[model samples]
Target: MAVYTELKPEAFARVSEAYGLGPVQEVVTIPEGSINTNHRIRTPEGRLFLRHTTVRSAEDLRFEAALLTHLTESHFPSPTLLLTKQGRPFLELEGGRVSLFKWLAGEELRRPQLTPDHLERLGLELGKMHRITQSFGGSRDNPYSAGQVRSWLAGLRRHKDDEVATVAEELEEHLERAEGQRGQGLEPRGVIHADLFMDNVKWLADRVGAFFDFEMACKDSYGLDVAITLNAWCFDNGAYLPELCRTFIRGYQDARPLAAVERENLFGHALFGAVRYSASRIRDFHLSPLPPEQLTRKDFRTYLARARALDALGPAGFLALLGL
Candidate 1:
């Protein structure tokens, strides 16, 4: 769905030789997600994922490769970054960066099929991943920072279009409230998967096969990742499933217990997560130049509704859902 460039056999052959991956037998394009081209490469040596992206800088791609390597070193379930003969994780080709990675075997779980058991596992895996990533020496600043949100809102205001104005108004209200409460409690900082939405996770049987797509990996408050996961995974039919959220927290606590600060700030962080997704979705769907078909636009309604609902629930109600 995100293939923006045509791939040729000759290019694959060059990559194979450069990486010593053996002769490339065939290449199949895998249509999933928006942004970046993904292809499944078959070789006599082994199966691998060949991903190409022009939108990100070479530095960003290299940072992602390093993050993936770090995660693998921590005994986490993530794809190993395949190195070139020159000992680099990516190849510069045709105005984009292409990287080969060991293909992970699993199916992506959708919301309808998700259960508390699944959330428990997701929580446990995320907890372990967070704990492991604490020692990662590399760091990337969050691309979706509060400042970025404010700038996006400013862009919307300049347009003067009715829809853009309405979205900007609503988003500003949420952002104002969420930003105002940032210091109610102290949140511990660490490496986090800033975009750990459901589609990014893969499952094999009952275990997490791998957490792919480290494109948005960055350093932030650890609670932000927890909040983002709960926002994405523990919701159904335009509402947050309180019991499911509780179960997820239970699983996370079993691995790494939440600090008092985390529990105190959970609701605010969740609201921040909701606002983040909603604002981005609006920018992508309404304001961005990319066509609807070329890029996937998640419905902004879900996150907006969740943000409003969480506002009504208040801190006590939100904490109570997690059995605090």
Candidate 2:
């Protein structure tokens, strides 16, 4: 289930009343992402996707709404909030930002194949989306920046959690070194989806459907952007798909080829991505008071292996493997 809990009509009615959205007859809770609770709200005559957050301060729901709206305005496939009788695109209430969207129409992408043609299309689509998003210039550099990574590494090196913290400390040290070597060589900053798991990219036959879940969207390095996509698309739980990487990189290049520095540091950004998700999982589940499943099941083992590969992925390694 994507939602942490079910929301009842009475509860929703309270929200509806505040926003003047009228009566809500039923509220069917949908899946809860790592950060948000989403429900499919069914009124007497229509259905809309309602995203509910636990605490007012836990999320930037308004930012999400604005981002979604901006993407929609650019003709990206993101769903826009429905208009109320008063023609408002969304309604803010005591429950947080309660906007309704016409449900995303295509089937979720499952086990997406990296066929040459398919990857080409995917890369081109992402390029167009990124171009459009860059036009907005609304967001800033993500707080989860390289500097934050460096600081966190220093903390881990202090070895606060015995064995777990020790291992983290070692890896963190390595990542810190990698970060130093990278030192802004990871260039071409722009808008990126950041979390474009194939699961988030919808499929409509041979064509691309829509990109969903703009919650993690931000401005970051174009190389880092490609790294995140590679993390999501090319690697799975246990192994890396070298062919898939080639296909995806080719596709991405078809849109905008990686620069010399960007291509060189792609592995570091991707390995960093692995550590990023693993840390989040550990912090969200083991370190926090939240329930077990509050953490996503999407495993980070794939990234860990990629991290292992990072040692061997010098410029020569990339050239030998991908002709980059």
The local distance difference test score of each candidate is 0.83, 0.64
lDDT of 1 by residue, 63-141 (tens): 8888887888778998788899999878987678898888888999987888889889999998998898888888889
Clashing pairs in 2: 2-31, 2-32, 3-31, 3-32
Best by TM-score: 1
Best by lDDT: 1
**TM, every model:** 0.93, 0.82
Give per-residue lDDT, candidate 1, residue 179. 75
TM-score of 2: 0.82
